[model samples]
Target: MPSVAEGVKLGIQECQHQFRGRRWNCTTIDDSLAIFGPVLDKGRKLRNWTKRRQAREQGSTPPAATRESAFVHAIASAGVAFAVTRSCAEGTSTICGCDSHHKGPPGEGWKWGGCSEDADFGVLVSREFADARENRPDARSAMNKHNNEAGRTTILDHMHLKCKCHGLSGSCEVKTCWWAQPDFRAIGDFLKDKYDSASEMVVEKHRESRGWVETLRAKYALFKPPTERDLVYYENSPNFCEPNPETGSFGTRDRTCNVTSHGIDGCDLLCCGRGHNTRTEKRKEKCHCIFHWCCYVSCQECIRIYDVHTCK
Candidate 1:
């Protein structure tokens, strides 16, 4: 898919198509732009376009950078009711893509002041920029590195930087902030509506099936998590029998069976036990729908007397 600029270009081209249908002159595009949607928001782009059009009328080409910027502006300006509460200044960290912390994934980010996409959506842009600069894709490579390494560059690294606040949360200065979208949620009707859909999903895939496993995993993922403590590493073994000492919490355990943070009973949490390799025996007569484990046993029938020899 094209960037937000590309999407805007397409939208503008659509407006041009509509304007041509009415057989109106295409000399001044501003009127057509407004009819289609928001022509300009910050006034910076609007001002630039005015000058560029005037310059072109004088038979001189606009500066290369200015032309590119104006074209990108035209693409973005084709949106509906775009509002730029802010703009870029020298002091603030402007990045390779020129997207500020206030801005987002260009195409859809500006549509509603609430861009519709996933957290990793920015990754695509980062990869594109990196490809242009020949940099690496890892967050570290995309961050403060002056030398673009593995063809990956993006504006996301600045988001994770520590804010000038004493608390651990995001900048305390912001209230109903624009940058904090992926995690933000409105109360009242909004929450109710979102929950309504998710609730239906939960009921449709009720527990006692694989849904139970998925639900359990999602519930665990939502946990806020406690601070790090003196965690250690140990392995649960077939012959070895031991329980966690410092913390009883399965979450704050010292070590894991496997490094991957997957199924609790997998390489994570406690080991799967000696059950990994075991043998089973079939009843000589019939199982009688009964099962036993060492001293523990279950049966459909109950005998009043104990059979010492038969029990084993």
Candidate 2:
């Protein structure tokens, strides 16, 4: 198994890559970790409060699980799984090897050979390490677990089959096939879609044979129950236009934006209606190219200027 640090680094990289153009682009991983420490501490306090049977005395509102949190958790877990599985297949980790438990024999035209990447092992290890961070067995923990599983499931559901063909003069006589993980971008896109449709959930307590168990349910009656694959949250997020130390929001001031974009990355939207500053930048690049008789190609340098927009 790869080290925990390796998995975390990969997760952070994926998060940043996926949200690069968004307002809350996950630029505060260190702050997030620091905030998580306080979250765990509060979880312990809440657990004690519940045990004392004095929940009515506090009258404090429950912590709100925002969509941002859900996205972060999902992407982080998926990133760890992806990194670990790829590392195993590449022989970078000593704990495991390529997946050899594929079913069925070679078909008429194709053979199922070569080491298949082991995603199951990756999922198992990710769950063990990532889920361990949630020490309290509460609704928040359950929510985190669900999102983590959903992330792993996204990766597994998107695995693609790649094949190499072998034949005489491209006759395609035989083929070797293996299951490969999809591009990280695909996973990011899928998660982003889920984030758009994320549901608001409320944690409720129910008495069971074992004990009083907390479970997450949709906060709105009209909203359907969230499936294992859906992302769920409990709280609304800050506007993120200005820095909020309590919520760890760094704000969008001075960030680059697309001048012509009509989406979230647009100057108007990204700057939160504060407007933006624009400047022209000149860039040099290879333009005209000619192929030589042998194989060498040559290109001429060209200069181009474009406007760059930044949030105020």
Candidate 3:
């Protein structure tokens, strides 16, 4: 008979380890495993109980490690982490007791976000969670169905930025290029120049600042747009068009719209199966609005929003 330690490893190896969907949860042969395939595929070893049993039957259980072999414990500990991520192990799960495991801060992580695991792991786990939800054939967002809640990080923060939320200026801590280019044109002149919503904002702000006299500068100085105001301003600009609300028809000008978690057959092929125009909104705004608009955004596709154009 294998020891408790061996059983722990075996449990960790189970890929359907703790499989579950919005309404279906399975990690065993007797449970529905079809829907959990992708999750299993992502970390098969961590969720393959049958393989663990086969190995146990073959008398392949390795000898227990001493304190000197603590590295082995790291794998075992991380295996538990993976299981928790898969929504198995009931109650609460946290890594414990790894002396040589420098993967993350070595300590008890009973509380979420208390232990700082590498950002990459957080990103990967969040992605798997997102995928597990998106492909689940359910209309519910992951926010409504996912079991793990603390595994996500902003893309910028995921890159190891010390901070990503409100900065010293009490703003989004994120922005773009500077205004005072060596060319140094007037702000209003620059605003009237061509109006690149992205770059021209900087030019406009610069003009507003310099337009005042130094004596009254402190009182009548720059009229910078607040976060709320800027948000409304860019509601149409690229700077503000992220995840641009998939409402109504893909055509910005079209009145009728249809946004649903429908089948992915067309999205995967960029064919939309209906001759829709997948051109960027920026590109569309530049046009004379003479064509019939039919656009769809396969978020997984290009980084920009596009308008689907049809040939007359």
Identify the leading candidate in terms of TM-score.
2
**Candidate 1: where are CA atoms >4 Å away?**
2-61, 65-120, 126-312
lDDT of 2 by residue, 141-250 (tens): 77778888888888888887778899999877898888888888888889989989998888899888778888888998887888888899876777777754445455
Q: How accurate is candidate 2 locally (lDDT)?
A: 0.73
**C-alpha RMSD for every candidate:** 31.7, 8.2, 27.6
Q: Candidate 3 versus the native: TM-score? A: 0.16
Q: Candidate 2 or 3, higher TM-score?
A: 2
Q: Write the residue-wise lDDT of candidate 3 on 1-312 in tens digits.
A: 122233224333321122111001112222222221222221123334445333321111111111101111222222323333322122232432111222343223111122223323423443443344433222122211221122121121222212223346666544221111111112112222212221111112222344622110111126543221011111121111111112101111211122222332222222233333334454323322333345533222223465444211
- Ten residues in sequence with the least summed lDDT for candidate 1: 228-237
Instruction: Report the lDDT tens digits of candidate 1 across residue range 1-312.
Output: 224334234334433332221111122323232311222111223335444443331111111112111222222222211111011111122332223334444332122233222213334443333234314333212211221111011112112221222224654433222342111111112222221222110101235533331111112236442111101111111211222112111121122233333544333233333222222333333235645656665545433432111000
Q: Which candidate is the best by lDDT?
A: 2
TM-score of each: 0.16, 0.82, 0.16
Local error of candidate 1 at residue 292 (angstroms): 77
Using lDDT as the yardstick, the better of models 1 and 2 is 2
